[model samples]
Target: MSLIDNINKAFDHRIRLGIMSILMVNDYADFNMLKELLGATDGNLASHTKALEKEDYIKVEKQFIGRKPNTRYSTTPLGKKEFQKHIDALEKLIGK
Candidate 1:
């Protein structure tokens, strides 16, 4: 298979890539944290997250932190495997 074929289209966008990168290392990250880390606006982050969630690449959790609402994101098992595959593909491409 081609290296490009192993790259996940779901994580093609910078914002989505950022989200996955963070989730890979973090147990979970809240919306505000991800926004700050990625330097993405609310709408932009939300859209990208929704896209990942739709692909089952990331799981979302909603809860109440006192009176405020909290949305947390974490990578699914499939997400981690796919992301690792994508990284491996990139590494192979670079090595070539």
Candidate 2:
């Protein structure tokens, strides 16, 4: 298959890619952490995160910390595999 075909459309955007990349290395990251790390606004991060959740690429956990709501995100096994494949495809395309 072509490299472009291998690239996951779900991770095409920089913010979404950043989210996945962070979740790949981190056990879980809260909404604020992701927003800060990606430098994204609340709406932007929430929309992208929802997309990933809809794809089943990530799992979301919501809890209360001191009466405050906290939302955390982590990558699923399928997401990890798909992300690795996308990375590999990019490397191959670059002849790396």
Candidate 3:
């Protein structure tokens, strides 16, 4: 298997890709923020985030702001490296 195969596996769905892309730039973003950005349902985002977290691809921090609890996401150092590699793999696939 090649590198693209790895990235392809990482982002099997476009929703997953969108999630990672958003987390790449920002240091941290909450569940609501991600849902707003991706236009995804809570269940949808939660499921995908759980998948990434299981893979050790993203770090999740849960805390409360005022009275309500929030889940914030940020790419782990390992995740950051993997995402960059994924991008490079995509560029290769595009013949760049």
Candidate 4:
């Protein structure tokens, strides 16, 4: 298969790309942190996150902190592998 064919369509959106990039570096990030970093609205972030979740690219954790609900996101092992593949494909496409 060609390198371009290896690209993950799930990351076609810049928002989803940003989400994976952040998760790659951080062990885990909460909803508020992602929203603030991406400068996206609650609905925007929620939808994007849900998409990633449905693809099994990210794991979501829910809990309560001092009576407040908290949602954290982290990349799964499979996610890391697939994301790295996507990055590699992009690099190859650019002849890097």
Candidate 5:
């Protein structure tokens, strides 16, 4: 068996995984962008992000844009590493 063959360990939370998936395709994503893309509620996204933050997998930048609160999220180097591992495991499982 491969080192990262365990899906549960590789991707525990679907929302967080989805967040990483989207960020993989984009340079950065704002709070609303992730919410709309993942169809996750504010609290849901917030909680999931906290989880990733605890793991240092993602970085959150909070500030204001034109007097409106804006939050941007980007995957970290560690996040990219884990995400790529997850993708590889998934692809292997799918035999692709």
Candidate 6:
């Protein structure tokens, strides 16, 4: 298969890519942390996260922190596998 074929469409957007990249290293990240790291607005981040969630690439957890709501995100096993494939494909394409 072609290198391009290994790239996942779900991670096409920069925000989604950033999210996955962060999750790859961290156990989990909360909404504010992701927003700060990705420099995405609330709506933009929410949309991209929802897209990832729909693709089953990320798992979302909603809870209350002393009466305040909090949302955390982490990558699923499938997500990690697919994202690694995407990175490998990019590396191959770049001759790295």
Best by TM-score: 6
Residue-level error in angstroms, candidate 5, position 21? 0.5
Where model 2 places Cα greater than 4 Å from the true spot, the runs are none
Candidate 6 structure quality by residue, lDDT tens digits, 18-56: 999999999999999999998999999999999999999
lDDT of 4 by residue, 1-96 (tens): 687798999998988999999999999999999999999999999999999999999999999999999999999999999999999999998889
**What lDDT tens digits, residue by residue, belong to model 5 across residues 1-96?**
764455545357789789989888888899998999889999998989888888888888999899999999888999888888788878888889
lDDT of 1 by residue, 38-85 (tens): 999999999999999998989999999998999999999999999999
- List candidate 4 stretches off by more than 4 Å: none
Clash statistics: count for each candidate: 0, 0, 0, 0, 0, 0
Error of 2 at 40 (Å): 0.2
Evaluate residue 88 in candidate 5 and report its C-alpha lDDT on the 0 to 100 scale.
Answer: 80
True-structure RMSD for candidate 6: 0.8
Candidate scoring better on lDDT of 2 and 5? 2
Candidate 6 CA-lDDT value: 0.95
**Residue 83, model 3: Cα distance from true site in angstroms:** 0.9
The digit string of per-residue lDDT tens for model 3 on 23-66 reads: 99999989998999899998988999999998898999999899
The stretch of ten residues in a row with the least summed lDDT in candidate 3 is 1-10
Tens-digit lDDT string for candidate 2 (1-96): 677899999999999999999999999999999999999999989999999999999999999999999999999999999999988888898999
Badly placed stretches (over 4 Å) of model 5 are: 3-10
State the weakest 10-residue window (summed lDDT) of model 5.
2-11
Residue pairs with colliding backbones in model 4 are: none
lDDT agreement with native, every candidate: 0.93, 0.94, 0.86, 0.95, 0.84, 0.95
lDDT of 4: 0.95
> What does the lDDT read for residue 72 in candidate 5?
96
Task: Please give the distance, in angstroms, between residue 96's alpha carbon in candidate 4 and its true position after superposition.
Answer: 1.1
